[model samples]
Target: MKKFSYFLAVMFLFTAFAPAAMASAPEKSNKEDKELTPEQEERLEEIKSRVDEIKSMDFSSMSKAEIKDVKKELRGINKETKAMGQGVYLSVGAIIIILLILILLT
Candidate 1:
């Protein structure tokens, strides 16, 4: 019957396209932080080295004002790390918003 043939065609198309859709998606990692890009790894290493260098210094010889300045510098480094990650989040957000607007307009 024509109805049976039409049903088969629809089922065949669905099965064929389903795997293609799934294949295009990337697999998510359980621990995203476990993977780091080269630049991120480099930054992490620099921060670690800076902390080690600061730890090796003799605080007894430095004046109180000098230690306060060092603490402020460490806080600044922490802020830099936070700022670096936020740019990616902001761009992704902007893209999603743009997509929603386009979808609604259509």
Candidate 2:
């Protein structure tokens, strides 16, 4: 009976600590924040601000050509953001898949 009780306590401790251990594991980079060089960070911020500016503009009052130009700039920003995310996204996806497999197997 004593041995069984000790085993139960050990199991309870293991279960409690399992999630903390997983949470503390080094996370896969899911964004370009830490990866960006100083110049790239400045450029990204500039592009983000430009995108916000475009969004806040009075599109209804703009001329057709101006709207088209803004649309082009928006598309360019989308491409740049996608490029920045490419590396981080794959790793994150892989981590998720591995976790799912572990869950299912256990």
Candidate 3:
């Protein structure tokens, strides 16, 4: 039980300091934002306008089918936006596994 408590304390300290250490590290070149092409920018602007139009619409008066169509359109837009963005996305499970690996290695 004492060893378990000590292990927990060490884990807590490690997790707390890990972010600080990472923050102090130099930023990678990939972290720099890339300039969007003219076509991409125009498409993004169109997407924004469409989203605004959807937001301003009265959903209560719309038919169920129309609402479902609108939702489908929004999902497509979400996929497009995600595809346009560049980043590494880690799921909760992956993050937990990474932390476990670090703890075990230490």
Model 3 lowest lDDT segment of ten: 86-95
Global local distance difference test of model 1: 0.71
Which candidate, 1 or 2, has the higher lDDT?
2
Clashes of each: 0, 0, 0
lDDT of 3 by residue, 1-106 (tens): 7996786677677667777887799987443476778898899999999999999999999999999999999999988877777334775445656877897899
- What ranking emerges by TM-score with the best candidate at the front? 3, 2, 1
| Residue pairs with clashing backbones, model 2 | none
TM-scores of the models, in the given order? 0.42, 0.48, 0.56
Specify the highest-TM-score model's number. 3
Error of 2 at 32 (Å): 6.6
Error of 2 at 43 (Å): 0.7
Clashing pairs in 3: none
lDDT against true structure, model 2 = 0.73
Off by more than 4 A, model 3: 1-18, 21-32, 86-106
Q: After superposition, how far is residue 4 of candidate 1 from its true place, in Å?
A: 76
> By the TM-score metric, which is better: model 1 or model 2?
2
Task: Estimate, for each residue in 2-106, the C-alpha lDDT of model 1 and write its tens digit.
Answer: 985786577566666766776788877434355667998798789878978988989999999999998998888778766555222344335545765786699
lDDT of 2 by residue, 27-74 (tens): 786463548777887988898788788778998998999999888888
By lDDT, the best candidate is 3
